[model samples]
Structure formats: structure tokens, C-alpha cells
Target: MPDSAALVKQLMFTFDDLVELDPMSLGVLIRSCDTDMLVYALKGSKAPIRDMFIGQMSERAGAILRDSIETMGPVLARDVEQAKNNILQKAKNLAEAGAIVIQRGDNANSQVIY
Candidate 1:
């Protein structure tokens, strides 16, 4: 397995930078990578993760997210944890299940995109 803790931290900074420059919605939008294509990839087999990424931000927003991540480095667990805290701080969810979320297309760090 990879070092998830470090991955989360990197992503947190990436996301923070993206949200700072182009807004969270914009960053998500840029990363969408063609919603239609994502839908096609699903082929009705399973729920597409792209939908989760696109929900809060547009395809353009996705671009920002990608750029931030690329410019920074791989996602770090601490970064992801911070992002998770950001959401948890606002929403209501325990931390135990955070790892499960990673497998569910939340992110490499287990931060729920949706």
C-alpha cells in the first residue's frame, strides 16, 4: 500500500490553491474531462465517480484541481485528511469510515469529492 497520510496532505494544498485561484467550483469543472465521456466509460455497469467530481464544480473547475495536483505532487494523506476535516467540520460524519470512502471514488486520500 502507499503512504496515504502523505498523499492526503499534498492534495489538501493542491485543492486549497485551486480553490484560491479559480474557486472550488471552477477547479472541479476543469477536471471533469468530458462528462459525456465519463458517462460512456461507466457503460451502465456502475455509478461513475466523475459525477461526484462534477457535482460541486464544473469541467473547468476540474482543470484547476488537476493543475494544482500536478504542480504540487501526488496526493498526501495529511492533505486529504485536512480536506476531509473541512467537509466533516461542516457536515456530520465519523472518521472511522473515511478509508472506505477512498474506494468509493472520493479521492486518492479518501476525501469525499461530493
Candidate 2:
């Protein structure tokens, strides 16, 4: 069996989990996040993660964000972690407010009913 810390870690919502969110939920999350923070958080992120976010915005906005990411210099690991945590906190707050659903484990792919 896993230790309590390990269990908690396993249950934690991570930045990568944003991929599981529906488009609308993702849009809400993106809108709530600060653009500068997003640029920092996405500094070393995977292509899919970057693409998912950029794809949700208007062409001009996406291009600007993409350019920002491309031009950004090296970011501190701690800053990246902080930005991701802030975004995750926003997501948790949104979920608690019934504005979005964060599906996990067995419900990860479940459909949402209106």
C-alpha cells in the first residue's frame, strides 16, 4: 500500500490533467489564468499541452501567446511550479463553484450531462 503522502500526491490535480477537461472548461480555465503566468508555466511544457491552450484562443491571441512562449528566456523551475500551482488552485476553485468538473481516475472520460 502507498503511504499517505504518496496517496495524496496521486490524488492531486496536475497541470497535465488539463488535457482531460472539455473544451468549454478549458476555455474558462484559460481565461482565468494570467497570460504572463501562462507563458512562464508553458516554458518547458510538452507540445500537446501548449497546442491545446493555443488552439482554444482566437488566431491573433494564439499567435501572440505562441510568440511569447517562443521568445521567453530561461525561467526558474520554482517560478514555473508556482504558476502551475496557481492555475491548479484556480481550477479547484472553479470546480468547487460548480463552474467546471474535474474528472479523474475512472471518471476521467465520463460524459457530462446538462
Candidate 3:
């Protein structure tokens, strides 16, 4: 059997993991995603994760997004998964293109230099 660390490394990066992103990196991700999709994606997300994204935006934009999420009503699980996947893919692409860094584990404490 694989070791615990190896198994952990094999796990997929998830939507909740996005909370680890620095402000600038998170901003890049927010801009990359569609507003409507974001509303759906955040529908049932934890308050902290939702706040992280919303906190990065202007007060008006954040309020609008907060209201949208609050009023988005029920969302299909698959749709939420799809939106999360799309956002994750965008973050991966950004990391690949060197537009942002996704620090993990031991590297999480490192600073992102522009």
C-alpha cells in the first residue's frame, strides 16, 4: 500500500483548497471565472471560502456577489462540481502559464514574488 503522504499527494486539489491562495493569485482566479458560475459554485460553500473570494472584490461587487449567492437557491450537485472543476482547471492553467503560484504543504508559507 502507498504511504499516507503519497496518498495525500495524489488527492485532487479542491475548491476549498483555493482558500490557501494569496490575495493576488485569488484575484486572478476570480477574474478568470464567470460571475454567474461563481454564484453557483459558492451556493453551498463554507462561509470562510465564500468570504475569501468576496473579500477580494470591491465592496459593491462583494455585496452583489454575496446577495447573488444567497439568492441563487438550489443548485444541482453536478452543476456545482462542474463549476468547481472549471475554476480548478482555470487555476491549473494559470499556474502552468506562470500567472500564479499554488503553494502547498511545506511551500505554503513561502512568499509569492512578482
lDDT of 2 by residue, 2-113 (tens): 6987557535767898888888998998999999988987876899998998999989989999999998888899998888878877887897788988776566566432
Taking all chains together, each candidate's TM-score versus the true structure is 0.31, 0.83, 0.83
- Tens digit per residue, CA lDDT, model 3, 1-114: 568764554355778888888899999989988998888788868899899999999899999999998877788999988888788778878987898888765574664321
lDDT of 2: 0.83
| Per-residue lDDT over 1-114 for candidate 1, one digit per residue giving the tens place of the 0 to 100 score | 368975664354432222222234333333433443322322221223333444456467556544444355445455554543444322222213342121222345444332
Itemize residue pairs with steric clashes in candidate 2.
none
Ordered list by lDDT, greatest first: 2, 3, 1
Worst 10 residues of 2 by lDDT: 105-114
* Model 2, residue 87: C-alpha shift (Å): 0.5
User: What's the true lDDT of residue 54 in model 1?
Assistant: 43
Report the Cα lDDT for residue 12, model 2.
70
TM-score of 2: 0.83
Residue 30, model 1: lDDT of: 35
